[model samples]
Target: MGEEEQEDEMVTCKTNREKEEKEDDAIATEAAAAAPYCYPTLRFDIPPYRSYHFYQQFRNASNPNNFLKSVNWSPDGSCFLTSSEDNTLRKFNLPDCVDTTQEDTCSSSLEDPYVADLIVNEGESVYDYCWYPYMSASDPTTCVFASTTRDHPIHLWDAITGQLRGTYRAYDAMDEITAAFSTAFNPSGTKIFGGYNKSLRIFDIHRPGRDFEQYSTLQGNKEGQPGIISAIAFCPSHTGMFATGSYSQTTAIYSENNMELLYLLHGQEGGVTHVQFSKDGNFLYTGGRKDPYILCWDIRNTVSIVYKLYRSSELTNQRILFDIEPSGRHLGTGGQVCCIFC
Candidate 1:
């Protein structure tokens, strides 16, 4: 009610607030001093990648709204290609790769976060992106990638300059264009293969449409012809062999020369979405829709799987991709909601 009383109350409230702030600061300082130092985060129990450091992060201002769709590593392990939903690819170079090396992949310095060195933008929304089987950042000509978009021609581009190198087009009997979901390059980089709804189309790089080969991977016509292929992985050893995984939970190895079905390894728990071969080309690893484990098979012996690498916990229809290290000892893959390494 009085001015003097109001002023005294205001001063007391200020004093209490300052006292609380000082107490909070003291508690935080004491907690920090009592905590123990943590070692650099790594997996010593793992084979080759016992030590992995978070070197950097990369962001692009050009396509801020698009989510990451796919990632493909270079053959030489120098750099990688990250594809976004906008039908664009970004090449994030590992600048410190020259002086460092890792047991599994080429190492980059733990300097400032790396930035996108080059951005390759195509006009259509990208369906799939694959690095040339022999891409190397050191050689500009060798730094190439293949991409496919729905209802659009498959284009191969120079990753360094983002220039269109070649286009592999497909036309139906009506002379209308056809769409594809997945693309791959032969180990020699002389041919391109695409996954259509029910078949895989092989194209010669020089003249894509002049003469092409088609192979059907559809196993069942009864289940509403769920014949769409999930992914394809080519053998890097040049053994004239490649593998195709489909929605029917079968992984088939095919002869590259005659396009003959060599062998079939079936009975996976889920629809095979992605397949990859080990560095030695002696084993194949596969991840499927709703599968909790990454299946590994010995190519030479198809009767039994070598092991099942554990992955994310859930039932998902999403197709996850996995990769093996250059040393052939470590394995990496992504799950529905997280990344897994085995």
Candidate 2:
């Protein structure tokens, strides 16, 4: 080959090699820059639950029909109760903080929460169950729980004796019984509230047959907002304030004085089935049916969501509910599939 042509060919080859090297370096740099943003992961620094007081089992070999539906702790924190699909409510007593017995039941995972305390089962199927707001083991006579049934009256049962204490009903003048989907007692335990399709009713605890007052859940007929409060919670310290979550995917705060709407908190893609205020009453956590995220909002600043935690994904066939620890150190929900402690 001619010297000039050979020299030109060698130079071209060297230039092409240098171009390929530059392209490779550029590709590597681009990937490094996109790594952190494209696939962001959820991280948490939640404290581990030091001890598991007890695990309440829902089902056993002989009792395979016990599917857990909901659980709630007493106002005094002395005990908690669970409602199951088998149409029964069971209470589990928690050991005192000073218990000398070793808490070998302690676990950080979602093990079968099996416990033995008390059981009250007499209903077709449970729609909702709650402990009386002032329920304390110290007062056995007054320590009771109330539940609503799809085809039965709202029965307030003595938690200690496993006997029916009272029954609240929402009936018409013609004496036709109505269905109650959810029920809760006022903070003072003087009155009971039942939630129906789009209405919330209040009845005197002494006389449970008729509602003293009925209030619609909608605010000024605001279209496409929270409807049919699936859950209701009253602040322990702030008796004048309470919150309700609806099937329309909204959580609302209201004042008890006049039952006036105070502040509305909205950020759920599915119907909110659970809502709870922290011990301090400054923050709230909400989760909904078919939604995997539990959103935490600051009542003081409701402009933006401050934090969020996830449970199972939308594919799961269960409605997930979350609860904060008594110490406020950790958060908990159903299913270990996608639930995080932090």
Candidate 3:
């Protein structure tokens, strides 16, 4: 029972411990090696109707700590803006986009550092927004965006410098801004269209301090049945074509000049939170709150079926539609796990 026996036992215990540790390390290494190579990591699949890449995900770091409510891409498609219920707007750079890859993380770069900045800090809820049209190359203004707040006002700012360019408030003729959900600029950047709770208003941004004109009134629905017009979008390619979606699951395209409803396509299963047109104005994208999906409508066809992504999944719930890239390359959805669909 002596000293030699004790030393032998101690040596055996140490060896066993080291062996077990090595085994654990080997298992971990194998799992890491086998982890799927998810490029873009935004869309589940790729190619044809499946190809998509992750641009980036963002969150609010200001007061109230609410999730983002809206987003818009720059006219040049180089940057995008995200507005939040917390009353702040953020601008993110749209760096060179890469196609989705099916390689493992180790084969490609694990992470690429693309950065976005906080350009404006308006102290109110930012419900809707849009980037201004770029008219001339020599224009000093890099980008322009409008943020509509609960205070019944629209604040325009130089997206690049965060300088306040103009403020459009409601007059007596126009009822108090019930809910401003979406904003848009005509292709030439001369006019601004805003969709509100009970009506739609257009502004002349070319002239500073100009008042907004009430273009059309949206049909209201019964309480708790979707009365609020939540989103609006102007067609980039179709000069006078615009679209509006509300909580009642209806998305209607209209003529910007006469405010005439051109067509109403119904596919949203929940509140139609937002709608967007592709750069060519061939397809209209709508975001649904109840079903929580992104629906693509073929504008050319009279009753084309809706193409949707992420139907009723956890990632799609409460996902609000923001802006699309100027080239119509990507659409941004706001939520805890914000998404960019190509």
Candidate 2: where are CA atoms >4 Å away?
Answer: 1-65, 94-115, 172-175, 219-226, 336-341
Deviation in Å, model 2, residue 63 alpha carbon: 4.3
Candidate 3 structure quality by residue, lDDT tens digits, 1-342: 889999999999999999999999999999988996454434445634432222333332434345555555565656677765556677776546544564334224434344555457776666667677772224656367777766647778876677898877655446544446667777777877777655677878865444767744544443222356777777867567877887778788878777776787777787787777877788888877756667888877849665776643334446454566544566766654656667
Instruction: Show model 3 residue runs off by greater than 4 Å.
Output: 1-71, 92-118, 135-138, 172-179, 207-210, 218-226, 304-306, 313-319, 322-342
Q: What are the models' TM-scores? A: 0.72, 0.73, 0.63
Report how far off residue 8 is in candidate 2 (Å): 99
Tens digit of per-residue lDDT, candidate 2, span 129-194: 887776667877678888888778788888888878777777745778776777788888888878
Error of 3 at 171 (Å): 4.0
Alpha-carbon lDDT of model 1: 0.76
Model 1 scores worst on lDDT over the 10 consecutive residues at: 50-59
